[model samples]
Target: MMAKKYSNKINKIRSFALALIFVGFIIMYAGIFFRGNPIVMLIFIILGMLSLVFSMVVYFWIGLLSTRAVVVNCPNCDKPTKILGRVDMCMHCREPLTLDPELEGKEFDEDYNKKSRQTKQT
Candidate 1:
């Protein structure tokens, strides 16, 4: 069996933002190659700018989520970390942590937080 991997939600979003920034730069750089085609270059530049702007929005969302996330000391690492929902992994140790006692000792499942699941469970 392959070991499953999980990452802290905040960290995941951060990395996604970072990747977007890189993609934006790459798109803009590709535009330079089409310098002879003004229309093509403009399209590339616009697309690049959009990607950058979207990344900023994602970063802002992460900030808001951080405020709502529950902070707790990871039992495995003894380090302060945040959990975004009912089930989230420790930022430092990747230990599966849960805020709900009913979920304790259960396997981590992201679907546990969905509205559909909540309705179905009841």
Candidate 2:
């Protein structure tokens, strides 16, 4: 069976924020086509601005969450990385890491972070 790919939570959230910015700009640019209708153009502009504002909020939230995440040096790459949950991939090498000893040698499964899943496994 093929293994599932994983990414650092921080990087994923950062990428998502970047995507929102692009989407917001695209939506705003689309408003140019509706120049004939002031109301329609205004609506599009507002929606685009909302997307940007929400992206900023996401960025801010992620920044705070990142500060609280545990930082550890990846054993494989010897580089520092943050772990958001029980199982997270190394930001630099994509190596799987875990704080729980029980999950140390197990396959990299994101489900290990879930309380219900852990309970079921035990």
Q: What is the TM-score of each candidate against the true structure?
A: 0.93, 0.94
Candidate 2 structure, TM-score to reference: 0.94
Compute the lDDT for candidate 1. Answer: 0.91
Model 1 poorest 10 in a row by lDDT: 110-119
Best by TM-score: 2
Candidate 2: which stretches are off by over 4 Å? 1-3
**What TM-score quantifies how close candidate 1 is to the native fold?**
0.93
lDDT by residue for model 1 (1-122), tens: 99766788899999999899999999999999999999999999999999999999999999999998999999999999999977888999999899889889888887877889867877
